[model samples]
Every structure is written in C-alpha cells, then in structure tokens.
Target chain A: MALAKVYVNYKQSILNPEAEAVHKALKRLGYGDIEDVKLGKYFELTIADGKSKAEMDKEINQVCDKLLANYNMENYHYELVETEAAQ
Target chain B: MALAKVYVNYKQSILNPEAEAVHKALKRLGYGDIEDVKLGKYFELTIADGKSKAEMDKEINQVCDKLLANYNMENYHYELVETEAAQ
Candidate 1:
C-alpha cells in the first residue's frame, strides 16, 4: 500500500483569523518568541498498491483539486510514502 | 528562524465521522482504489532562532500538550526545520 500525507492551507494573501487568535493566545501564554502561526488541514489517504508512480501522482492531484482544496483560497501539497500492504 | 510543522490526528480508538464521510465521498467520486481516509489538523509555527535543539524540542512538546492537541483523543507530532532569518 501507499500513504499520501496531504496538507491544505490558505494562500499567503488570505487572512486566517483562527491562526491569528492562536498566535495571540500563545503570546498571552508567555510564548513571546513565537513569530507566527498558521493553521491548516491534513489528510492521510491509503491507496492499494498497483498503479505506477505517474498514475498515482495524477490521481492524487485530481483528488486534491476536486475535493481537498478550494482553488480560490487554499492550496494543497502531498507526499507519498510506501507502506507494507495490509493482509 | 525555525519552522515547526505540527500534525494532530485522532487516536486509532476514536471514531472520526468526518473522515468516514470523506472516504465515502471519494468512493462515490470514482476513487474506488482508495482504501482509507483520515483527516486531521496541521499547524505551522515560526519561532525565532536562538534556543538549542533540546530547548526547542521541550518547548514544542509543551505547546502541543497544552494547546495543539487534546490529550484524551488526539495524538500530535512535529517536524522542526531551520529557515532563513526574516529580513
């Protein structure tokens, strides 16, 4: 099997109020050295191993564009890792 | 500076309905080969560079336990990467 670790985050130009709140909270909690904080989404996908790497890449990209990411505001990237097949 | 990428996910024993719904959605969308789907939270934290690795590690652990994760149901991990100092 293969595992895809996908991350989806807002574009740099976008404002993230939740992350801003967390940053402020951290400062209030005495973590003054923290310069910035960004909150995002993560997904783990397990796929049966059969397709070639190129094919897998294509499918993953399609899935991200179609479901996992909002093209107008968010961007996504993923890393693929090989794993032992489950019995 | 240092960039910390933190990932928080539900523990295996916990049921994640959102993730299950996503898996079903993918299957319906023709990604039948996708065996499983898990969703979680991701955080990117930028910290001023000064502390030793051990200090950074300890601080990150404390932050995760105190803010980034729910110890009862979620597990958290992080990767710290050195980044160029801000101009």
Candidate 2:
C-alpha cells in the first residue's frame, strides 16, 4: 500500500477568521507566547499500490484539485510513502 | 520565533463518520484506487521564543491537551522548529 499524506491550507491572501478565533482563545487560556495560529486540514489516504510514483503524484494532484482543495482560495501538497501491504 | 506544527486526529477506537463520508465521496468521484481516507486537523503556531526546548515541549503539550484536542476522543502530537525571530 501507499500512504498519501495531504495538507491543505488557505492561501496567504485569504483571511482565516477561524484561526484568529483559536488564537484569541489560546491567549485567553494563558498561552500568551503563542503569537499566531493557522489552522488547516490534513488527510491520510491509503491507496492500492500498483502504480508508479509519477502516476500516483498525478492522481493525487487531480484528487486535490477536484475535491480536497478549492483552487481559488486554498492550496494543497502531498507526500507519498510506500508502506507494507496489508496482510 | 519558534514554529509548532500540531496534528490532531480521532482515536483508533472512535468512529469518524466524516472520514467515512469523505472516503465514499472519493470513490464516487472516481478515485477508486483510494482504499481509505482519514481526515484530521492541523495547526501551525508561531510562538515567541524565550524558553528552552524542554520548556517549549511542556508548554506545547499543555496547549494541545487543554485546547487543541479532546483527550477523551482525540489524540494529538506536535513537532517544534526554531525559526528566525519575528521582526
């Protein structure tokens, strides 16, 4: 099997109000040293391993573009690791 | 400054309906090679650097336990990196 770890985050130009709220809450909770907080989505995908690395990369990118991320506001990147096949 | 990347995910015993939904969606969207999908939360925190590595570790753990994760149903882990101090 292959494990694809995808990270999706808002674009730098986009304002993330949810992250701002979390930062405020953290400060109120006495974590005064936390200067900034940005929250994003993480996904782990277990894929059937029969394709080449280049093929997997292309497919994963297509998945991200179609479902995992909003091209206009968010960006995504993924890392693929080959794991032992399920017993 | 220091950068702390935190990842929070549902415990193994917990039923993550959302992840299941995503998995189904992926299949319906033609990503048939995707065997399973797991979704989680990721956070990047920029913190003022005045503490030793040990101190930072303790503080980050406290932050995760108290606010970032629900100890009853979720698990969290973090990585810390020393970055150039914010101007």
Model 1 chain A: weakest 10-residue lDDT segment is A78-87
lDDT over C-alpha atoms for residue B78 of model 2: 92
- C-alpha RMSD (angstroms) for model 2: 1.7
Candidate 2 has which clashing residue pairs, if any? B1-B85
Q: Please provide, for model 2 over A1-87, each residue's C-alpha lDDT reduced to its tens digit, 9 standing for 90 to 100.
A: 999999999998999999999999999999999998999999999989789999999989999998899999998988999999741
Which portions of model 2 show Cα errors greater than 4 Å? A85-87, B85-87
Tens-digit per-residue lDDT, A1-87, candidate 1: 999999999999999999999899889888998899999999999999899889999999999999999999999999999889742
TM-score of candidate 2 versus the correct structure, residues matched by position = 0.95
Local error of candidate 2 at B67, Å? 0.3
Deviation of model 1 at A41, angstroms = 0.7
Tell me the RMSD of model 1 versus the true structure. Answer: 1.5
Q: Report clash pairs, candidate 1.
A: none
lDDT of 1 at A86: 46
Regions more than 4 Å wrong, model 1: none
